[model samples]
Target: DVAMPDAPARPTTPELLPPNRMPKRGRGGSERGRIAMLHALAHVEYSAIDLAFDVAGRFGALFPRSFIDDWLSVGADEAMHFAILDRRLTAMGSGYGALPAHAGLWEAAGATAHDAAARLAVVPMVLEARGLDVTPETVARFEAAGDLPSARILQRIYTDEIRHVGFGAKWFGYLCANEAIPPAPRWQSLVRTHFRGKLKPPFNDSARARAGLTRDFYEPLAAE
Candidate 1:
């Protein structure tokens, strides 16, 4: 079931662009503005589906059955999330590809393809963990604006993301323990070697702790 290049089919619309080239998501105060926000979320979940599968299919053999089980479940959840957002967009007369999305999401998978540990660290620990930090506020913004439906969807995604990050931390810790490498330093080393962006702060320390990605794992890596 492995595709050679392992790249998913690119969506046709909204035009993919480099992160810097993409415009900011406008405040969701207007109908158009709200559509844009949902579209952006749809794009991320769509890309996430591919990322989850890529991690499993591309590197599953390196680990055991539990690894495959976790990632496959993550991939399935991402697919469903994408469907939910896309359906919401359709109800609003816009769809997933109606606006451009960040093109850099898949780069993390490509960057860490050769290292299972790096893939877990960057994708789940760093990338998905970010969702835990920001999604609650995003959910509140929708709720404050009287868009409880959108807020509910985000709430569901946020809840699922906690477990996704947990899977990354769990597997990464297992790998470290199996090899007798110190988990924190090895994680830091992997991030330094593999991740391109800086770890910005105002972290969701509580949710991250629940995911088993405690402050000790990422705090030292945050920039001053």
Candidate 2:
């Protein structure tokens, strides 16, 4: 087992801002707006690569080999997602570093760094599951703007993210069972303890169910 870094290295550009300080990203209604949206998405994917690897490196020893295998595969997927998004940004005449991004994405990782179960609960189950919730409409927005290539990229990422969340849910259940705890309430408890943000609704129930993250695990915590 290797040591995990407290944070991932990032490029000097794309000055990071607090989420509240970040500029509003309107719908992809114009070229500039679309670039902003894509850039932000690229940043998320970039950060996710490190998040996946950190989980493997930091907590892999506590779980089975399959755990390391799954998270490493997730890291690879995140890397690919970032690469394609960065390429798309370049094709659009704007690159990832051209705009500012929020640093809040990594905060979830920091909050749950101590426990693998908590990490799994908050990162993939809550954070990445959120991607499942919102990505369809984001794709539709790109399609509405006549940006088929970008829309297709998001669609592909959305599909891969289902499996990623599944990995998290699967292993979290494994951990819960080992400790003689019920999976759903254990997940909810971990999330409530480690997650900083509210569980917003309009959730994609079908996609979440496909990931083994059913309403039982999250619906109780949904924001009213």
Candidate 3:
């Protein structure tokens, strides 16, 4: 019966900045660059922990128990991701709060807060799916830089994210089915309305297909 907060509680440091104002995290080729990359990722994982739980807390009552189960699992995965990244940062002589993070990470959550389907459409289906598209390149860069441990970590996270996106697609389809609406168009509409960013190209088609987030849902939007 408790109400969801407008935004999640944040740590005092790593001063949050607008996406445009955030400092560039350079290519993961040098120690400084890698540390910056890891810290940014750690911040993402930390914010994701709250995003997953907020979905459960704010919208769980509208769905079956399985909804809560799925999101709680995602939250746990995010927690583990944050912990490992923080450890990696410490090993590299940096930590999570040493750099500013993108403040707009939670903007999607706030934008879609009123509708569970929109939340799914924007948060996991759009945002986390973007991770799948970009992470392989990131892992390769880490490996090329001789940062095998960080590469492996990114690889593991990439695999888990496929499942998380699958969950979003699953539940979004379920909700659409319940409403007798087509999932793809509905998802497209929600993304257009709730997501502020563009659906960039060079997408990972195979990985997205594996997660059931086909191009039909996003391609039309991307073209628009």
Which candidate wins on TM-score?
Answer: 3
Candidate 3 local Cα displacement, residue 204, angstroms? 0.5
Q: What TM-score would each prediction reach against the true structure?
A: 0.95, 0.97, 0.98
lDDT of each: 0.88, 0.92, 0.92
lDDT of 2 by residue, 1-224 (tens): 45788898888988999899999889899988899999999999999999999999999899999999999999999999999999999998988899999878798888888899999999999999999999999999999999999999999999999999999999999999999999999988887888878999899999999999999888889843
TM-score, structure 1 vs. true: 0.95
lDDT of 1 by residue, 49-158 (tens): 88988888887887898888999999999999999999888988988878888867788888887888998999999988988988888888889888888889999999
Cα miss at 12, model 3 (Å)? 1.1
Ranking by TM-score: 3, 2, 1
RMSD of 2: 1.0
Candidate 2 has what TM-score? Answer: 0.97
Q: lDDT of candidate 2? A: 0.92
